[model samples]
Target: MTHGTSQSTSQSPAPTAPGAGAPSGRRPRRNKVPEVTLYFWIIKVLCTTVGETAADLLNEKAGLGLTGVSLLMSALLAVVLVVQFRTGAYRAGVYWTAVALISVVGTLISDNLTDNMGVPLETSTTVFAVVLAVVFTVWYRRERTLSIHHIDTTGREAFYWLAVLFTFALGTAAGDLVSERMDLGYWLSAVLFALAIAAVALAHRTLGLDAVGSFWIAYILTRPLGASIGDYLSQPTGDGGVGLGTVVTSALFLTVILGLVVYLAVTRKDVAPAQEAVRHAD
Candidate 1:
């Protein structure tokens, strides 16, 4: 079964609003993220895992302290986001690059709290949860809707990225708290997160959970699931990992993400033009 946003059954071309474009009569705006396909989920999980492993590699092996690593990654994220924002339409390479960078930066935010400031994971988790709620509340207050399918305006896009950043940070803290405090180990923690995501999907399918709610729930769960997988692959065997080493794991995932992003950029397979049209019609 597919996860994240449920697929739209309607196959008709999306509607377009009058005067929705520049005086040149261009088409209306569209969603930035890929369509909710198996490929989308695969790449999302891969990017999250890369974020975890890459952060660990930089902080530990590259001799960058948490603060240093965070600053560097944050800078990179900013640059990528600028490129993403400047593009007139969805470009997979620019979009996914921003996502991968944000993933690493998000993990670093939590690491700074727990490792550098000695804040408890519980506290970080709570703070991030509150922050995420505030973002959503404010976003909905201004935008009138929280549907990812309607992500066309600059305001909506801003809120969407902010919410995404908080989800990563919250997921990092929650996942770490569960794994370390409960001693569930990386593999088991991954299994638990996967199971939880599955339950969310079941609720969406069987219990009539709203599409936005189900999407956000799954999006949040992906962080921990990705982090757990990263830890399981990168840590030493004695520590319950496969001993792949952080460098290798990070490299492998990054390479795959890059390849996929390139393919999507060329093919435009994930562009959500149909959804954008539907929103305009509404």
Candidate 2:
């Protein structure tokens, strides 16, 4: 039930206000998500896969429909997010639960476009990619950086969540387009995404891609990887899946996530400092 490693102790140097001299030797603000470790990525992909199966379970198997499922999950996501934002620091349970809910909600958004409205997966993918790009552009322009290592303020948290939402939506669209339209089966698609994430990691380790870029690239890829795994597990065997069913798959992953969250909460493993300095120093 280990969620991830505890918060990092390395402090970032403080930045100065526009046109002002920088602060001297102040600590950098800690990021929201834990440091990009093997454990972090493992749980992220798990939550996303669960998100896909969970959404399908409620919408199709459970007869909630797209709109009904979206509404219910969105309401629950909002409640969890409220609790997450209100807390003074990170609690793994509240944070990861919100993430899982948003994952489902994001999948439903793309599903609504394709299933309910007949929009093509390619079109949805393009639209979401553009939206995500725009969000990153704006966030970078205003904040002057996009590093996950410094997310102490409420505004940064908002931006982080928004970007995450788009990642899930984009991943769902791209994955479906590849699997259904492009005729790449779930297993191959998952392999492709896993490779892409591996490439990002290699780039970070060998080519010195900034930590922020590496993190986001891997984060975006995890969604599709998770969705493919979810489909492979939950869909019927006739359709090439193991036929475990969405209910079982979702419940299993949720239990694992909950166990990890509870352990982290008790240990305070994911908690970071309340007010640290900015780290965009040269």
Candidate 3:
């Protein structure tokens, strides 16, 4: 997917001293989000790559053109999101499907603005970044927290998904901007974003940065990283890519995503326990 990301563990929830969204003595809510594990990142990257190449495949091979592809994918994304919202807790297959679809939709949104509407990549990138910042500001002011571990309520999940959508759009625009401006080949662009994410991880672990902030930053960074990887592998050799073609790249990544989703569904490795303690500590 063009844009997506999140964290490792969660703080347990509170026992309801101060009233919030729900009342006290309510049944424990399950964490809607998954654990921030290695598997999570791997699948996430696969999703981003799939989003990129798959969108290209549909647009070019399917002959739907950009507008048709955008509308079709957006409709499919809306349907998947509905199912995702209906789920009581994290289900790898459902969640990743939503993510992969959202990635495609997000990319399409940006592509439409740039390719169809004649907007510059720089303008779209800046616009999406500002919109994402405003969303984060509002989400934090209302919920007083941005941690993925505590997203048990519909409101929180809504904010989370909204953020994910913007990240994808922004990543697509910004990734294209950087790659084209610097004249850096896809491989170099990938390396650059990978290093940037590593710096975020290092900052969070060693430089006293907030975990939630670091996680979100890294999450957004991964979008561009994955996009670069997709372009590198899918574009022609003359265009400085590995020449795998969009279909091959999309299918390969999709297959990997499918395998991971099945593995997670069976093992439940990504599911984090709902923690009442985490809420209280905060």
Candidate 4:
């Protein structure tokens, strides 16, 4: 979404104003993120799912302990981030690869906190939430806009990745907290988060919520929703999950992510246009 005053979606009409976060008619030097669209959301959720199961698969099936898996994935993430930054613009392959790796790394961070350090999931959730809030506050204060539409500057891109990393960690902690602590089972947790996302969509579409606010809230919410889904499919039924196993679940989602990435790369359908000056309500 653009960084500007919002127009209302409810009722007849509301006075609309342009967002200053992204200057109108001023093209970004290099668009580092995809346009916010259905494709973006779909791939984001899939990446979250992979974040959960792939972490499990690597830690367990791949015979890498938590520390080993964490280190390995983190190194890979660093390498990809370097490549992503070097390319300069948003290449679908580079961008999505970084996202997928970051997802894994995010999951590992939460796991390290909760499992290795004996921190409670609830505590971790609260901690990550606070950390994410601080990051956003600082980012917005510095940039004057938290909108992803114009992530062209190095500082903005840096803030963007930092925020994304926190979101994944926060999502993992919260999802596990709800499913394990609250005894809500992975399936029920997925449904709950899904409904919450739907509510956010409705609020934005019909209740005149700000476009940027709605987008970020939904983006944060989807992480837990997708993680719950991944856990439900991969965990054992005896443990309140469907028992597809981590290997299978990871493979399935990875395949879908790969296909979608290829489609976006070949078609460039999700690329941000040079003139993305306005963001409208659905």
Candidate 5:
């Protein structure tokens, strides 16, 4: 499951290059995001899986159809984002909570487009891809970098989360389109995306792909990979799933996410070096 070392920049933007200290007087800011670690990717994929299954659980069992479930998750996501923004540094609990909520909201967004509004997955996928590109274009234009390491400022943090949201939405649409069009079952779809992620890693290692580029590409691919896994576990067997049901799948993944977040909080192993610099500086 592990790919590279703790210092692998291929997983994320290279953390503040060695000894690149802050200027004369101003205090250094801690990055809002965690350092890319084995734990980071593990928890990220789990969160995406929970996002898919939990949304379905709510839609089917909570008596809240697509629209109702969408509104409920969206409101909760807004509240979590507010709390996340107000925090001074990367709080593992709050940060991961916000991510998990945003994942559900992203799934809902894509589901609403496809199931409620009768939009085609093809159209939604293309639209979300374009929107994500625009977000990145504006984010880079304004901040001069798309690297997560510099997400210490409110503006950069905003851009980061916005991009994350679109990635999940895009992944959902793209995953569904591919699975249906290619007649691939949930398991096969997961494998396909997993292979794509592997290729991206290979490109980064051998072909000299940019760190940020490789990270974001893998990040987007994880969404669909996780979603396909979620579907495979939760859907009925006749529907090409194991029939474990969404409740079981969501609970399983959420429990794993909670445990991993707690571990990261306690160990602080995933804290970015830049954030550590800020801490030591303070």
Candidate 6:
């Protein structure tokens, strides 16, 4: 799904990092993002689950309220992103670390709005959805493509991360809203999202859904799906979870993510073919 040049056909070889276009004889770096694969989705959902539980863990255990946890995670996310942007090519450790941190920050953002600022989940969900839409609109208008395969430029990377952040925030809010209104509890909510993602995949394969659209849709759905799974595992039995607690849930998912990242790093299977580079506007 990520290999085609369906989004843009006129890409040229570009410097891998910002301001690295000097007349050096060295070869340009490869893409900074991972190629979409089964590993990518697995790690993504795991990170999303970690995001859900890790945020709660910090808020409850660190004595940092929602606001404090948000600030702390956001600072860490900023630091990791700086390091990520400075790296010229995809590094599994750096890239996945940033993703995990961002997931926590994203969940915290939604929580603060709901628990701290008294904003309703519906309003936060709507606001985040609109913000995400604006980000995509501006990104496409400026870059002319939304394909992750082409995120070699700093500008595109910025837009991509911004969209990712909002997607998490939106997903958190929407998940809470749906679970509460429908009274489906955590396991059932997880099942609902799982089925939704399956339907999206089916549509993409058989009903002519475009790759980018299918990807983003699945991406957004995974956040809530992961959140539901986390909640189901972590919350008390009376609360419809298995009572594993946030600490266990977070640690469990993080371990899986670490193992997957290590495997991907060693195998290098998620790196795209250098010849199938991202197509960017001139």
Candidate 1 residue pairs that clash: 15-277
Q: Is 3 or 4 the stronger prediction by lDDT?
A: 3
lDDT of 1 at 147: 66
In terms of TM-score, how similar is model 2 to the real structure?
0.85
Runs in model 6 deviating more than 4 A are: 1-28, 275-282
Evaluated against the true structure, the overall lDDT of model 2 is 0.76
> Which number leads on TM-score?
5
Q: Model 2 segments beyond 4 Å from truth? A: 1-31, 271-282
**Which regions in candidate 5 have their CA more than 4 angstroms from the true location?**
1-28
Worst 10 residues of 6 by lDDT: 4-13
Candidate 5, position 212, lDDT? 79
lDDT-wise, the better of 1 and 6 is: 6
Question: Least accurate stretch of 10 residues (summed lDDT) in model 1?
Answer: 19-28
For lDDT, the strongest prediction is 5
**Per-prediction CA RMSD (Å):** 4.6, 5.5, 4.8, 5.8, 3.9, 5.0
lDDT scores in order:
0.81, 0.76, 0.82, 0.80, 0.85, 0.84
Which stretches of model 3 miss by more than 4 angstroms? Answer: 1-18, 21-28, 274-282
TM-score of 1: 0.88
TM-score of 3: 0.90
Candidate 2 lDDT by residue in tens digits, 19-38: 33222222234445554445
Can you give the TM-score per candidate against the true fold?
0.88, 0.85, 0.90, 0.86, 0.90, 0.89
Q: Tell me which residue pairs clash in candidate 6.
A: none
Model 3: lDDT to the true structure = 0.82
Rate residue 81 of model 6 by lDDT: 98
- The candidate with the higher lDDT, 4 or 5, is 5
TM-score, prediction 6? 0.89
